[model samples]
Target: MRQYKKVLLGVASIVLIIVLAACGNIDDSSSSTSSSGKKTTSVQTTGQVSKSEYAGVIKNGHYLTSKARGLTANRNSNSLNITSFENGLLGVSKSYYSTSNYIFQEGQYLTTAKLTNWLGRKSKSNPTGLNPKDNGKKNSSRNPIYVESIEEQDFMQKNGNSLVLKGITIGIAMNTIDYYQKIKYGATYQQTITSKERVAYGKKVAKLIVERMRKIKKIGKNVPITIAMYKQAANDSLVGGSFYAKTQTTSSNISNWEKMNVENKVFPEISSTSDYASNDNKSFENFQSQIENYFPTISDVTAQAKYVNKKITGEQVTITTQFYSETEIISFTNFIAQVAPKFLPSGVPVNITVNSANGIQAFLSRSSTQRNFKSHVFSSY
Candidate 1:
């Protein structure tokens, strides 16, 4: 009887160990759930939250937009203490510019409704056939789409190692123009003008504003000016659309006449004649060719690269690649950093971000003083 009890106990101990091991395996496979019932994966080492968590924080467009505007308006300091999610997602703080006082004065002449109407007049198929009007309209008490504000901010370059403080951003708010209707219908204004015509018009508007701004004696004569137009659509609070133009004063003539000149004589060097300011389209084409010749694996995939003077970061190279697995993100990002600069204008510092179908997979940035790129991996899948 004693021998039989000992054998039975041993068998029970073995079965208990097997059951515990199976439970451990199940726990390993399971993910933690948030209060909203969303599964979350924690990176214990980096303490980085999942992309969904980051998106949840950023999706509050009103709050984010207000925060960005407030940060730009406050002239008391240079640095801002952003939350962990923002830091992790954006990777850097103080990347945007605060517009100078002179630009704000010029903004008074341009209202959102007026600009829209101006574009409407320029449109080839203006159903109403509105006449082209000069930008002398009184500042409307309420504007549907207007230049709400301006700011001067910094831009990161060279994988985030260099910083450029020559960015001027014009904030635009679209309050009307079927603001709510477009959301439900999924259609915005149909383009009546050719892409070339639209670009020409935008450039003309920018040149006029730049001319007025140069009249301000406080601004330097040789300042390399980077003008960015950030537009917030009525339906969306975030800056969904942006346009850019770059120019510099090569002439010593700082007279009122020189400042008033709207012709090409005012700006000796115009970086781009397009709407977005930078020479991104040509650079993108060149980058595509380089990729095809060098990296065959991703050569056939459709890729797009643009130099964006972001609100938070002065200037950045945002690249969207064809659907790529998370594991390949690092390799691809390194490859881009190596080849992209070759096609872009030299000496302009800019950071790089790699995006896939899933979302932003990696961010490579450097401060102006740093030489090496500090990379942040967000999502692999």
Candidate 2:
């Protein structure tokens, strides 16, 4: 972990001056730029998803937005799952829609309202409902809204200036717990969903979804499709859950579902669990302890690390603070900037968010290519 923390002092000043260095939901840019100052995500050529242009540049400086936007907020009751469901879908899509072959684009086939109806419970009013009907039954086993939300990602290949849709990826956000109210506006009771049942239901929904996309959406039969299942984390859970399994289709029909041993666990979680990456947890604990020791005013420090095949891949840490002064924020950020790479696991991108009760104070990220962190201090005004 410590070996990857070698500090590069050459570009420290230049990095700190940049406003926003990467693309994300919370950030300004939709394109990702590397340390070399060139946009690492772009599709300058036509035909096949270009590796250099994975994000797929639509215009000179603009990026294309999916037909469906902002509907994600209504997808899950838990905010954490919403973020996980969206980001994790793309993460899983990279495997099937390789950037080397296809450029990235938002799902264009599904509409916000259509998705809303699909996620809705099966009923006379909404025939597209993917969730099982409640049938006024008080029992969860008999009926529950097991399917939470749906997401789509389109993979494109360039032909001259125009782009060709080569594939469509769908993400099924499934619930681990079925929260039901026996009566309207009554007490809510949760029915725990087992892993076996969760995966089985997810596959059924995926196949059915593809069938509809072809019949109704007019999707070309030759366009490849990928389907991934993401397990939604409990609303109260600190970290959002991750995609567990994915299946790819050559034509229109999905086949040979492959199991993905992916998971997301918050730091300071149960260390006794078999999945616990012992060394990684220890490093996070040390990082938390150090922050606590240095800044007593900081409220808390927590990390959500993603594991693939039992190995740590990426981590996002949040530090809640009581400080407001820019000097104090920079000072604390500098301290974190110095100790983070030294104490935390490396070779994976790590993003740290410093937050105040009001909102986000600053954001710092270390990409896999860089030895140091690129940061932005939000304006206090």
Candidate 3:
């Protein structure tokens, strides 16, 4: 399996560290009632860091997966967009559901079979498909699958003995480019989807999904659902796609639409375009340059920098090295730890992974809430 270098999960997540100079720390917990109306022992307490826990589940440490897991696994083709689509949805969900108040569960309502029908071309038999009906011709305008796939996330709140649904977030991943083969083992043709066309189709699917979901038995009819439109990158794109806009259900339909500016861009590539501010592009260039100049033996040096509202949020630097010795990896990672903070985005979580032919050789990361970066070197000796 190809390991996508761009993924630096939890970089933008909040790492709340309450020092409690005066009062004690406040812990995020949930209370639950027994099925027979009896009270169970409260597992939550307020104080310094004791152990990792979540609010709503019967278990303390592990999160519960949806009863239907991996049903929509075949929806996405690109490896980069899959990770981004999943993690990015949670980030977008933060606006609607606070982590302290809600626990997350995999999408519970939508089944793989349901999603398969929705992603297929709309037909007389499969009326729920979001794509336009397949005409005989391969015209770019009529042939493409406007809606690539659908992703759902369910946020739950502790109501009684069980965790009830608080809200739902659905991501409509639209294809920027669609590939098709007219005949079996024939020439493959490609079509490019314009931004306007993608948005129109994506919004159409969103409306249809909301309307269809309202009829479902499990999902609440008027549940507060946050739907986001993501323009997926090309199949071969190294960086993942971005969430450009989001909206919530005001009534039965989507309303209060808002544009989002979340992006994951190649650090050096931004210099050629006016995507991000000049300051960040230059910082990454300088950081990349220093490593190249000093460590000529390094196989490759690349960084995927995330920008939200035009400010750098997090950047992942992958340094591919030919050296396999533990001592050499330790030296290279030590240098990276010292200079990364100075050149990369300040105070934001930055992950640096050093890779060799054997696998991950070393790793370094600094959380957004901290000043110093933590480093680890794998022992290959």
Best by lDDT: 2
Model 3, runs deviating above 4 Å? 1-63, 67-76
Writing each residue's lDDT as its tens digit, candidate 3 over 94-171 gives 788877777666676886567767777778988877788887676665568777657788877765445677788988
- For 132-161, candidate 2 gives per-residue lDDT tens digits of 765766775556677876778888776654
Q: lDDT rank, highest first?
A: 2, 3, 1
Better of 1 and 2 by lDDT: 2
Each candidate structure's TM-score, on Cα atoms with residue i matched to residue i, is 0.31, 0.78, 0.81
342: Cα error in model 1, Å:
2.2
- Model 2, residue 159: what's the lDDT? 68
**Comparison by TM-score, 1 against 3, better one:** 3
The most accurate candidate by TM-score is 3
Q: Residue by residue across 203-300, what tens digits does model 1's lDDT show?
A: 44555545654564544354434444332222222112232223333233222211111100101113445544234446655766765554334423
User: Per-model C-alpha lDDT, please?
Assistant: 0.33, 0.72, 0.71
The local distance difference test score of model 1 is 0.33
Clashes of 2: 8
